[model samples]
Target chain A: MEIRSMRFKANASAKLADAGLQRNLRKAKGKFVDTRAVAIKEIDDFEGTRRAARDLRDRVLKDLDLWLERFETQATARGATVLWARDGAEICRHVVDIARRHGVKKATKSKSMLSEEAGLNQALAAAGVEPVETDLGEYILQINDNEPPSHIIAPVMHKNVEQVADLFAKTHHKPRKTDIPQLTREAREVLRSHFLTADMGISGGNFLVAETGSVALVTNEGNGRMVTTLPKVHVVITGIEKVIPTLEDLSLLMRLLPRSATGQSISNYFSVLTGVKQPDESDGPEHLYFVLVDNGRADVVGSEYHEMLRCIRCGACMNHCPVYQSIGGHAYGWVYPGPMGSILTPLYAGIENAVDLPNAATLCGQCSAVCPVLIPLPELMRKLREEQVERKLRPLAERLALKAWAWVANRPALYALGTWFAVRYLKWLAGGGDRIRVLAAAPEWTAGRDFPAPQGKTFRELYRQRQP
Target chain B: MRVALFVTCLVDLMRPRIGFAAIELLEAAGCEVVVPEKQTCCGQPAYNSGDRASAAMLAKKTIAEFEPFDYLVAPSGSCADQIRTEYPGLLADDPEWHGRAVALASRVHELTDFLVSVAKIEKIPGAFEGSVTYHDSCAGLRSLGIKDQPRALLARMPGVELKEMTGADECCGFGGTFAVKFGDISTAIAAKKCDNVVATGADAVVAGDLGCLLNIEGKLRRMGDEKTKVLHIAEILAGDA
Candidate 1:
């Protein structure tokens, strides 16, 4: 995916102007936030579970090499082939080569953010193999000229039922059905045939168990199962950071993952695939392949940002963010949006160009509070901002202004004298009005609202006068 | 307890009444309150904007100024938050200031928190209002855990009828410098916040921090809502009972 993170402010303004998008996003924001809160309350020892999950993830990241080697050995022993690709291009090359080897003309895919990161569909298409999306949300986006998923868990969260109905009517050449069940039925009918016909199946693994050599696929719909099972060749594309040391760890995280994302006590389908179908087994893929992608995970692992690798891609942080709630996903202009996007976009896309991603947040801490893995999101953002300052990426005028303010703030007499004069100057700027119409150093502050005029004596002066 | 009032720079300049009200509330709660003449801004504007050096300088100055007191209380939650929660982190690497910063941070409290928790005040001797709604400033609510304290204080007022507003805990978009930097987005958020406050049809909107009150009040006035009064929680608590 292209790094459009630099255009965040402009994109946010454009998104803010779209009332329809605002309405839909606001509704989703409330629903997701409320449901997540309720879902969390229903679980016993939820915080304890979250702590255990965080510890396990941290343990896995600390020994990523050992885990990966163990996973490769175990998975290979279980008759599944594992390949490690350092970057997206390499991952794409391997996928294309595998598709051609299998004589795959068409492949059915479940929702895989890793594949999106790898641009596998475009790679496959260039290699003369078609990709069919089996997940209903992914299918809707795929049919609509391959629009990127607005959300991680819920691909078409930005789209209302009416919009989906219109798109389905246009794409399927049928009458529009605004009802959700009808829409699902129509999508299922269209996708079922593709699943049967496609030669290869591509899906993302939620968790890679190092001990068992098993990949956990968590989904609310049956399509994830179909995409992995129906095709002749099944390939799992996922980030290298998705590995866990044991199935015991996976069980604890799965407890929080579904609850945190979509607010379900448990997802409908939780499939654990150990390897390919045995010779005696009737209905499963003959070949199982794992593409463990490391676009920048290796670098982030030992760095100060190793904690970010703990993310389960739950989308809980985004679901709970106030800034993300105000501005929809497209405003972020990336594959990821909200709090996780603010952190990941800069790391993955290049921090120099993606500086605005860190600053977009108001440091509300809701994302941090809701995170199942307990990523200190605000602290990470603050550290990123500090890096930007050190790199001199901040504007010179703003930087100079901050330095000047600090200089004044460092000295009590200077701060007192400066503010005393500033108050009087601001009052004069008000021109005998209740609110200041114009001011130096800040025109935007007075754009929509007036700056409240300061009153008579500064508190220090008042306190001195009132001394008995 | 001898409390040193860190009347935040905003309350000191734009609305000294809030400072005086804070003093009155503290005095009524049986604490000896003193205003430290050397104290100025809390350096949150610098800290939040990623200028740790400036924030560190101000933190040192603040720590020195309030070092003599048994307790340091601020009228603004944000200022208190900066002093109490952030100062330790800001000066963590400083060999000279780290211990002092941590010491100051431990004794610091927001006005309502001090009144309710430390002072252990069962009732305040002042109040007057119609149906009043309270805005939970982000720092006070999230940082200081000060949601119920002000409301608990207000509950003591006989004339004041507390009406809850939607999104009371939502940020009013006065993120210190954020309002000036991203004015359009700030104004949009403030406008939405003001709309929620207005929806309650309350006679006045009150909050623990002056920054939020000013932002929400400014938006309300801009939207021709001059009649809906905006007051700091201190003012309401200090009003005649």
Candidate 2:
């Protein structure tokens, strides 16, 4: 909810030191990667599927306004109110206004990153309404002092069972459960009462099917079904980019989403709600509303970053990312985390406020390789870096250093002289050892690893001697 | 064929031996190797840092100097990738430079990739007696499709047992400027990489790029595992390890 992306370095340092969080990160890393590998391998033509998914997304994004309008018309025809929000504040205002108008006392929410982006829970609470997170991970975060979800799909992924055990004991006043099923059962039991009593249900749409005017919700838990059906009113808040042309397109994307996100053939529950409960339908909401939040997405649609809009939020990119693997999601210091977060946070939140997010990655390209929609994540981040330079958003020292290096690099003779001196100076710093443990100029580098010393002569000098 | 060796800035300054080793491998494959003295950097630092002007200037300079050679080869995958993949995109708006960049991109290759794919050398230049695990540098693996090239070359060596480490393709976090700016995070990632490398119980960990090798080796030494060797693919393939 808060933009602390400016403190990325400090937050990353703390996360790197947080032993419990590190353990959790390490434990969770293998499952996502290994399972996705297995799931993808099972597909006869996974690359073709990825291409189709990319095309599907790009097609919708190319005519995004047309798709959104079609979705609005279809949804309205099916007796659902479609509201557009320009940004987070408006999204929250729309939801809160709906709640106040309905005299809603409490609302149960499934896992919706857009809601997190809108700070929907805090807004509802401020408006004198209670918001309960029904998804297991989201519920855990809710009970734990309303801590922000560190991960997109797995909200409480930063916490280990031990931490959750302590939190559950402290908050639930129940006996601590060390085993996972018991803990999950405890959470389900706790949320069951709120699910039934809640007058309004809030959800995030995985994909809005324009063909059927459907809001598709994908989740591992049954909460998605309960949240949408067991309430008087249902409000779906999602990004405008979530729209697809047709249900057939949804089918094509569904083949990749769950497999990429959590490596499941299909999630436990996939609900497609067309409209409010008809007279014949006994178990559905009375009121249905769609709140499509543009929130900087419209600006991205036709830009160089339009490829980013194709993301289905499967989070395979982040799951495969090495930086995300090292520092968990919270270190990103935003509602979104990992490679996608690095791009989205800078674009949605001002780049000036979140400069480090773009520069934090090693440009490892693992994210790009794993993305189901095949977003060139590393390239996009590089473009963001270019934008930073264009806007003069980077620090003066870094810009100047690059400028100086470029100047020397352009002149071969000067560059040779500079490098010769650099090698000798570094060799002197190494004190004849094979490594330099303390580099005064780059303390950051020597902080954790020794610098391998130069091999005494530059390659050019060696090459020249070999020639003569 | 006369091949100009783009020795790479890191190989030029940090370890000239990799350059020599690359030259040896290329010559063994029946190619005349030339080191273009005018070359300094591939401008990855500036390009990645978003200084396109500097990156473009260096790219153009590199393109002009290396253009005359029959082929351009580099010891490092990242730099080769910068020239082969990124240069055209970086200079795309300029008609003259973009064409040059495109022409040069096809001619550039990483050392092992050239050795196996282009040179098609059948005999190995060097032999090793112990086990070695390969680290796939990110750019080489993803950008240039360089996974099998180095391994295939190493397979030709005598007594070289390739012990595959878990997540061999995973990043070691040297990411150039990223290692310095986000040192702690880079170290943390490299620490896990070291763990994987050590778990294989190989005598050496080798990679196609010096940047990743340096990071892996630096972290390995800092972790007090001095016996395990960290070598470039050129060194191991050239029997200099």
Candidate 3:
């Protein structure tokens, strides 16, 4: 996808003004938040599980190469081809190469963020092969001029039912269905033929178990099963960080993923695909391939951001994030969105390219509090800000202002004098009113809300007078 | 106990009464309170903005000034959190300062946390006759585990009724500089917070941090809600609200 993270401010402003997007965001936010709360409450030891998951992820990331090689050995032993890609372009090349070798015409795809990262659909189209998104959300986005998904889990979360109904009517040339079940049925019926006729299936692996060389695909809708099983070829496109040491670990993570994601104790379908179809197997893909893409993920290991690699992509962070809730994912302007996206977009896409992504968050700590794997998202963002400062990526004015504030703050007498004058000046600006209706220095703040005028005196001044 | 009150820069300038109210609460809890005049900003703006050098310089200064006190307390949870949690990490590379930072961190506490846990005050000196919905400022609620301390303190007041607001623990978007940097999004987030605050129909909306209170109050007034009171926990506990 195009990296428009540089335009975060403009994108956010446009999104905030979008009433329809705001309504969709609110509705989706309520559902995701309420369900996850109930689901988490059901767990007897959610914290302990989170800790165990973190340890497991950290252990794997520590010896990531060993785990990946083991996974390759096991997968190769089962007659599945495992390919490594250094970046998104490499990933596209591998997938397109595989498609050409297999004489594949159309590929049915389950929702995979890695593919979105690779721009795989566009690449396939350029290679003269068709890509059909089977996930209902992805399918909607695909039919709607291949619009980039605003959310990782719910691609069309920014769109309301009315908009979807209108789109379906225009695109499908069929009667519009307003209700959800009817609309879902219409989509399912439309996607059914594509699923059967597609020459290849592509999926994003939630976790690749090294012990068994199985790709664990979890989805609420049955699209994952169709995308992986119905076609002649099946290819798994995922990040190298998705590999885990054991199936036992997958069991623990599986318990958390669905609950943290959509609040289900378990997804509707959980598929563990190993290698190709066995001789006795009647219905399975004839060819199985794994494309483990290491696009900037290797640099993060052992770095300050290693914890970010532990993300299960449950998206609980974004669901609870107030900033993300206000402006839907597209404003983030990348494949990834929300708090995790704030970190990933900068790391994967150059930090200089997406400078605004890190600064955009309030460092509220909600993202860290709700993360199933316990990634310290806010802390990571703060570290990213530190990186920005070191690189001089932040605006010159901001750096100078902070430097000036720090200089004054270090001198107690100067700070006291500064505050004393500043408070009085602000109070004067209020013109005896409790609130300052206009703050010339901060037009951004005054654009929406009034700045509360400071009290007439600084606390230190009042306290000194009260003494004796 | 001799407690040094780290009057956060915001409390010092925006609403000095909160600082005075905090001193009142501390004195009522049987401590000799001293306002360290040398204290300025907690350097959160610098630290959060990624200016580590300035943050460390300020942290070192704060540690030196307040280390003499038996305990150091702050009215704002964010500043207390910066002192208690962030200072050590910020100064980790400096051996002498890191040790001092660690020592100071041990004595640091947010006002309500110190009141309920450290001071163990059984009776409240201040009284309020109205109901209030509490806003859990982000840092205090998540970083400091301050969810129950403030509520516990409020419960001690005889006539106070606590009405819980929905998503009380969510951020009010007054994330220090975040309010001004991304003011539109901050306002939208604060607008949602105001909706929850107003929905309770309580006499007032209260939080431990003045930053959040100011944002909520400012946004509430912008939304034309002039009636719902926004207050700091110190003001309510000190009978200054």
List the lowest-lDDT window of 10 residues for candidate 3 chain B: B119-128
Q: lDDT by residue for model 2 over A1-468, one digit each (tens)?
A: 789999999999999998888888888987888888888886789999999999889998999999888999999999999999999899999999999999999999988998888888999999999999998888888988889988899888888888889999998999988999999888888899999899999999999998778999898989999999999899999999999988888889989999999998889999889988899988899999999998889999999999999989988988998999889898888889999999999989888889999999999898999899999999999999999999999999999999999999999899999998999999999998989999988888899999988889898888888775
Give the clashing pairs for model 3. Answer: none
Please give the ranking of all candidate structures by DockQ, highest first, separated by commas: 2, 3, 1
* Tens-digit lDDT track of model 2 for B80-190: 999999999999999999999998899999999999999998777888889999999999999999999888887877788999999999999899999999999899899
- For model 1, the superposed segments whose C-alpha errors exceed 4 Å read A437-440
TM-score, chain A, per candidate? 0.97, 0.99, 0.99
DockQ for model 1 equals 0.67
TM-scores of the candidates in the order shown: 0.97, 0.99, 0.99
TM-score of 3: 0.99
**Number of the top lDDT candidate:** 3
Candidate 3, residues B1-241: lDDT per residue as tens digits? 9999999989989999999898888988899998887999889999999999999889988998999999999988899999999999999999999999998898999999999999887667788999999999889989999989999988888899999999999999989899899999999999999999999999999999998998999999999999998899999999988
Q: Which pairs clash (backbone N, Cα, C closer than 3 Å) in model 1?
A: none
Instruction: Report the CAPRI category for model 2.
Output: high
Which DockQ value does candidate 2 get?
0.91
Question: Distance from true position, residue B232, model 1, in Å?
Answer: 1.2
